[model samples]
Target: MNAQTFGPMSGEPVGPAFYLADEEHHADGGGTMLGFWIYLMSDCLIFAVLFAIYGVLGSNYAGGPSPRDLFELPLVAVNTAMLLLSSITCGFAMLAMEEGRVRRTQGWLAATALFGAAFLAIELHEFSTLIAHGATPQRSAFLSSFFTLVGTHGLHVTVGLVWMATLMAQVGRHGLIQANKRRLMCLSMFWHFLDVIWVGVFTFVYLLGMLR
Candidate 1:
């Protein structure tokens, strides 16, 4: 037998299967997940600092544009609905991916993106209206804390939209690969985290501001 026909010990050249890309792909996936988790932790730390700052500065009204005067409950209600719906749709996207349904995943992702976009639109409108009414962040300590807390969350949502777009592109290019699924999982966590933070903002900033 030729050397190509078999290994030195087993008399076989091993299975006819060995691809560098496949191996590298798995390694890349693992590294990507680890790096993403580290990034998430760092993000948590940043949010924690922002939250602490908000806690300290939240009550300073500076006699201008208090939350009670500036916050429109009806508009915020719509914004809340948009974000909550997006989270739900994002969850559906994950479910579709888990079932290996690529088209359904894409549909859910599209829906989630639309809802997220709506949330951003409404928030921008709210900010514009407030600024037009002379309730800009520069107007008061209350407005400053309010903007820092809510604007940070809005910025995160904007980033999430970008991330969602990238994920949709990957899904289009690669289908529902394991790596894509893992990334979707991380994004899901991030989306849900933002939802929770919004809850805190609604309760502490909006609702409580009205009481005071």
Candidate 2:
């Protein structure tokens, strides 16, 4: 409502100092955060279902290769490291942004993008190697589930990389304005969520496969 309208409702005179923008902006921030969190929760449900499916179908190899024959711990470990490092760099970017150090924030964001790219490259290589070894998704039920779970995660990473690049450009152009800072926070949450998911995959899928 306009100031005059509000003033009449309050039975007081309107002041020149009143601003609706401040209230709107504050509400906008809270709304954006809430919307994104709801989105993340939905994504959590998607992954939960995927994990459940994989758990049920994981051992149905149809006499084909199991995780032991397919998984390379050394390469998987390196891929995990790449993603974990990206998380660190992303955190550093947030800190820099908090301090209003635009150049440092941009540098750290760039570092994060590099690590994210490295993670994708390593994942792609692993997929290619598995396919080359005749462990295609259609080879067995186990292979199908593995590819679906891991490939879905890879797809998320690819999108994250794209978002990271876009956000970097935005920061470069806008210099960490409030909008850019908000976007950065959302990206950080997303990237860290992926990191958490990968940890689950590593332990449940990779490590447990070794034991089984």
Candidate 3:
């Protein structure tokens, strides 16, 4: 009877198994990033369409209130600051994550969530004030476009906050495991993307609208 050796001393199949596992892990990571990029692209397209619609119809106020008449630049500026600050705090969280500091990462994430919540609160207040003043979407083409664009962004921020809360719970339970780290990275991208889109909105929808 021939003796069978399954040990590494006889150059068994352990090395190939590990290599395949590593390959599969890498593939999974790459796939996740790719899928996330695709999702972001789709979101970008949605925003682009909204922007285009606004450009076409923003001036048709139907003899109603215009941008300068309605938009409170000072308040909007404060809201923008909140979002921008949240982005910075989110970056700090990512740094902590990279350093494997779970507590610090969660702290930064909590701070970011707070800032994001503040932003949403301000935006909601603005919306409510506008609606109370009879500047609703049904009033004019301009108001319709304005509400659609800004409201969509606000909805995204709300969703992001919920997502952040879920992630915080996961981090507390999992302590920055590879999956949690990947989720954080994805959220980082999403948060920064919203920041960029808001800048465009502030510039085109608010700043230029005020001038027009």
Candidate 4:
């Protein structure tokens, strides 16, 4: 159960044509997938605690802006679509890789990155908008809990974008090596995992807040 070092394939003379056989490639792929699942479990633990805190403090607006006062459904909808689109584009990238189309794969990866960037931009805008309206996290217990849950999700997206860009650079420099391919697949899981978490964020933080 040792974690594997992800890079060029073994005995493949790391300079050109970095091909790895299906066996070696699949082994590493399984390892990467397992590792990512573990990471996601840890993230879930962190989110669970945040959700509990938010649950306790969610109604304590303390004479400050409430969810109905602060949330713009249309803006949050747009942000949600951005993340969903990125997840789709990331799936396309994986498909392209499976079919051995390097150029097309890069194109899909680039599109995914663009969508992710858009999501992050909207998130930053939303945060700024809230702060401008005096809805800062420090303003109330509700706000503090709100920012912690949503901000943690935003931070994950930021890291995912960075990871995508680094993988894209590797794809360009080394072409579709098996390890790189496996790593890309792992990233696809991470990207989609974030998207799923965003769904929860939208449901609990946005929808439930608005309802309550």
Choose 2 or 4, whichever is better by lDDT: 2
Model 3 residue 163 CA deviation (Å) reads: 0.7
Report model 3's TM-score to 2 decimal places: 0.89
| lDDT (Cα, tens digit) per residue for candidate 3, span 115-155 | 99999999999999999999999999999999999999999
Candidate 4: Cα lDDT at 158 = 90
> In order, what lDDT does every prediction score?
0.84, 0.90, 0.94, 0.88
> Per-residue lDDT for 120-185 in model 4, tens only?
999999999999988999999999999999999899989998998899889999999988888898
Question: TM-score of model 1 relative to the true fold?
Answer: 0.83
Models, CA RMSD each: 5.8, 3.6, 5.1, 7.7
- Give candidate 3's root-mean-square deviation (CA, Å): 5.1
Model 4 CA deviation exceeding 4 Å by range? 1-27
Query: Per-residue alpha-carbon lDDT of model 1 for 1-212, expressed as tens digits?
Result: 32233467977565333344445766667667677779878978877787778778877877775667778898898899999999999999999999999999989999999999999999999888998999888887777767887898999999999999999999999999977888898899889988988887777777877787
lDDT of 1 at 136: 82
Residue-by-residue lDDT tens digits, candidate 2, 1-212: 44542365666755433455556756568768878999999989988988888899999999989999989999999999999999999999999999999999989989999998999999999999999999999998888988999899999999998998898888889888888898899999999999999999999899999889
What TM-score against the true fold does each predicted structure earn?
Answer: 0.83, 0.90, 0.89, 0.85
The lDDT, on a scale of 0 to 1, for candidate 3 is: 0.94
